[model samples]
Each structure stands twice: as C-alpha cells, then as structure tokens.
Target: MPDLEDLYREIILDHYRNPRNRGELDTPPAVRAEGFNPLCGDEVIIYVRLANGVVDDIKFGGQGCSISQASSSMMSAIVKGRTTDELHRLNRAFKSMMSIEPDPDDPAPVNGNGADIKLGDLEALKGVVKFPVRIKCATLSWHTLIQAVEEAQTTG
Candidate 1:
C-alpha cells in the first residue's frame, strides 16, 4: 500500500504529465492573466470565461516545474463551473494550506472565512508548504486566476 505522501506525489506527477485544460480560450469572451515566478522562472497563463457570475470554462498554458504545472492543471480542473464566491473560498483555503504556520497535524485547515473548504485533489499540494520557496510555484496559477477573474468581472 502506498503511504499518503506517495499517493500525493503520484497525484501531482499525474497532473503534471497530463495537464487538464491545457490550452487557450478566445480573449473576447475569456479574460486572460499571467503569473511568473522569478526565483524559479516558472510562468503560468490562465484564460477564464465567466458567465452569469460563474466560471463557464478555463484553460492554462505555461512552462515550469512539476509543482507549478500540476498546480495549474489542478486549479483549472476545479475552478471551471464554479461561481466567483466559491473560487474566493477555494483560494483562501488553498492559500491557508500553503501558509507557513499551518498546524502540522491538521490535514484540513480552516480559512480566514472560517470555512473548511474541501480542497479535493488540491490537498496533494499541502506538502509544498514544507518547502517555503516552492509555495510560490504552487500558487502561481491561482494568482493568475485571480487576475483573470478580476478582468472577467470588469470586461465581462
């Protein structure tokens, strides 16, 4: 039987190898944003299509380490069809998971919103907190998603 760490590693690697929603969306209907991590030279571009205050579709393009690419792929998979409110909750939860002071024993930490948002496959990224510098890599797509969402709101 694989240990929890091994399972998580496999999940991450799977997403990295076969990324989900890996492509682009037309900009007129989709808002695009890009995030870059200078320390590791990881770049992520997110294209989000919002309709009726919900994410109708999403896609990603980038080149980076496994962590960044997998994180982007996982995020793209989860965020599509989610409302902006749910996206915010997910962001808070994910960021909390990546926080430096997270309780080591707690597998699911509550976000500032006081909601224990289920991270689903995203839980695989919790181990990233152990490596401080890599947190940015894991979060690059999320930041880009935020920007895309903001632009989507304004231009949508």
Candidate 2:
C-alpha cells in the first residue's frame, strides 16, 4: 500500500511538473470557469467544449501549488471525450472521496459497487483527503470543471 501511495505521489508530481492540457483552446469553448482558493492563492481557469452531450475537448490554465496544478491537468485528461453524465458522476465520486459530504438528493454514487465507479488515474488524488488543508488544493480544478460544464449545458 505504501508503494502504491508512492506511485500515486509520483504521478501527481509528474502531472504538476509537466501538466497536460495546460493551455487555452484555440476554438471558441462552450464554457469556461475560473476557480480560486484565496487561502493559498491557487487559481485555475477551465475551458470546455461539448459536442453531442460529450466533453469533446477540455483544457486548463492555472498557477498554483503542485496539487492544484496536477489536479487540473489530471482532470482535463480524464474528462476529455466523456459524456456530461459521466463527468457528473466523476465529480461526485471525487468529492465524496475527498470527504466532501454529498447532498441527500445527489444521486452520485459514492464508491458503490457499480460498473461505472472507476476513477482511473484520478484515483491518485484520493489521498488528498488525509491532509484536510490540501483537499481544496486537489479539488479546486474539479469544482471549476463542474461549474464550467453545467454553465455550458445551460447556454449550449
């Protein structure tokens, strides 16, 4: 388990140092949202393009700590080409894993034994919950992503 945790750390660091999708999209994006953690000065901007109810493309630009930057990078990679529904599920799962309580009405599965409950590389972030202070660092981009996608659905 420790080895796996180390691997997860390595993955996070790699993404932070060499982020993926760390740029603005050339095409006009369907929606964009910015996230800021005033406590630590973490900021992120998310750009999303939806097509046929799918996340056709996504990108992010941000300046922050390793956790924040890596979270945004990993989020962009995971959400690309996923359906809006899938993105919502992912958002719920991620938040729950980070110890964020879910609303009673939120149908988002919380690590239930469902076929769709896979977290993939995003699982690397589950450990952030251990450090409550760092939880926001890891979640800043994810929350921004949800905001961007929901806003896009409303306007698109």
Candidate 3:
C-alpha cells in the first residue's frame, strides 16, 4: 500500500492534471479576483457568482506550479453552492490548516468557531505547511476567492 504522503501526492497530481472548474465566468454576473505569488510566480484567477448570499457558480483560470493549480481546482470544486459564511469558514479552515504546526495527537483542525471543518480532498494540502514558501502557492486561489466575494458584496 502507498503511504499517506504518496496518496496525497497522487491526489494533488490528479487535480493538477485534470483540474475541475477550469475556465472563466462572465464578469457582469460574476466577480473576478486574481492573485499572484511573486516568490513562486504562481498566479490564479477566480470568478465567483453570488445569488441570495450563496455561491451560485464558480470557476478558475491560471497557470502555475502543480500546487497552485491543483489548489485552485480543489477550491473551485469545494466552494460552489456554498454560502458566503460557509465559504469564509472554509477559507479560515484551509488557511489554518496550512499554517498550524502538525500535532501527532491532533489530526484535525477547527475553524474560528471551534467546529471541525471537513476539508475533503483539501486535506491533501495539509502537507504543504512543511514548505513555508509553498503555503502561499497553496492559498493564492483561496485569497482571491475571498476578494471576489467581498467585491461582489460591495458592488452587488
């Protein structure tokens, strides 16, 4: 059997190879946000459409390393149909997962509300924290998603 790390690596590679929600949405109805990481030259563009405070649709486009692209792909799949509050909680949970030191006894991390957030395939990215610089690569799309949602709130 493959080790957990090997499974995670395969998951990341699968997303990178066949990204989900890989495209663009029309702007008048969708809020677009772009994030660039100069350290690694990973760029991600996120388009989000909100309806009744829910993510009506979401898509992503960009070019970067496997981590960034895979992360954006995973994020797009996870965020669609989620409410803005849920998205925020997920963002917090993902970011927290990226930053927190791993504890052998504590495998799961909670969001601000102290509730366990099931990360799904996103759990594949937990290993990214081992490389400090790659954490930004993993989170670029998430930050852009937050920006797009905030923009939608201000303008819509």
Candidate 4:
C-alpha cells in the first residue's frame, strides 16, 4: 500500500492538473471574492451561487501553487449543493485540520476532534499543517470561499 503521504501527493497533483469547478459563472446572480497570499503571490477567486440558503454552485479561478489550486478545486467539489450551515461546519473542520487557529468571534463550532469531522477528499490537505508556509497556500481558497458566501448572504 502506498504511504499516506504518497497518496495525498497523488490526490493533490490530480486536482492541480485537472481542476474541477474551474472558471467563472457567466451571469451576475453569484457572489465573488478573491484572496491573495502576498508572500507567495498566490491568488484565488471564488464564485458562488446560493439558492434557498444552499450552495447551488461554486467555481474558482486563479493561479497559484499546487496546494492552493488543488485545495480550491477540492473545495468547489465539496461545497456544491451544500447549505451555508454545512459550509460553515466543513470550513471550520478544514481549518482545524490545517491546524489554523479558529477566530474567536466566528460562530462555527470547531470541536478539535478530527474523528467527528467527515472531511472525505479534503483530508488530503491535512498534510499541509506540517508545512507552515504551505498552510496559507492551502487555506487561501477557503478564506475566499467564506467571503463569497458572506457576500451571497448579504446580497440575497
């Protein structure tokens, strides 16, 4: 069996090479947000459409390191058709998995027990916690996603 690291590397490369939910939404019925990592010049733009408090669709566009790009791609795939509440939970779980400190003011419940969070393919990014510099790379898209969601909530 391949080691966990090797498997994660393969998953990350696959997403980077063939990103899912890439590109932009054609019309204005969507919310968009961008995130940039000045240190690495990595940028990501997230486009989200919410319907009835659920993510109707999501896509991303930008250029960045393999980690950032892949994480965005994976995020897009996981978020589609999920409710805003679900996104909050998943976002908190993803951030925790990356060992990022939760914002005290944020209402998302992040109970540190990984076993309670069902990350699925997003788990491939857990390795990022070991590399402090790359953690930002992996999380840039997530921050952008949250912004997009907030934008959607406010507008509609």
Query: Which prediction has more favorable lDDT, 2 or 4?
Result: 4
RMSD of each: 4.9, 2.1, 5.1, 1.5
Cα deviation in Å at residue 24, candidate 4? 0.4
Candidate 3 clash total? 0
Best candidate, TM-score? 4
lDDT of 2 by residue, 24-115 (tens): 87545557789999989999999999998999989899799999999999888988999887887877777777888644554455456333
For model 2, give the 10-residue run with minimal summed lDDT.
Answer: 106-115
Q: Mind giving the per-residue lDDT tens digits that candidate 3 earns over 75-128?
A: 999989998878877777887788743323322334353338887889899899
lDDT of 4 by residue, 58-83 (tens): 98999999999999999999989998
- How good is model 3 by TM-score? 0.90
Best by lDDT: 4
- In order, candidate lDDTs are 0.87, 0.85, 0.87, 0.88
Model 4 has an lDDT value of: 0.88
TM-scores for all candidates?
0.90, 0.90, 0.90, 0.94
**Which regions of candidate 1 fall more than 4 Å away from where they truly are?**
100-115
lDDT of 3: 0.87
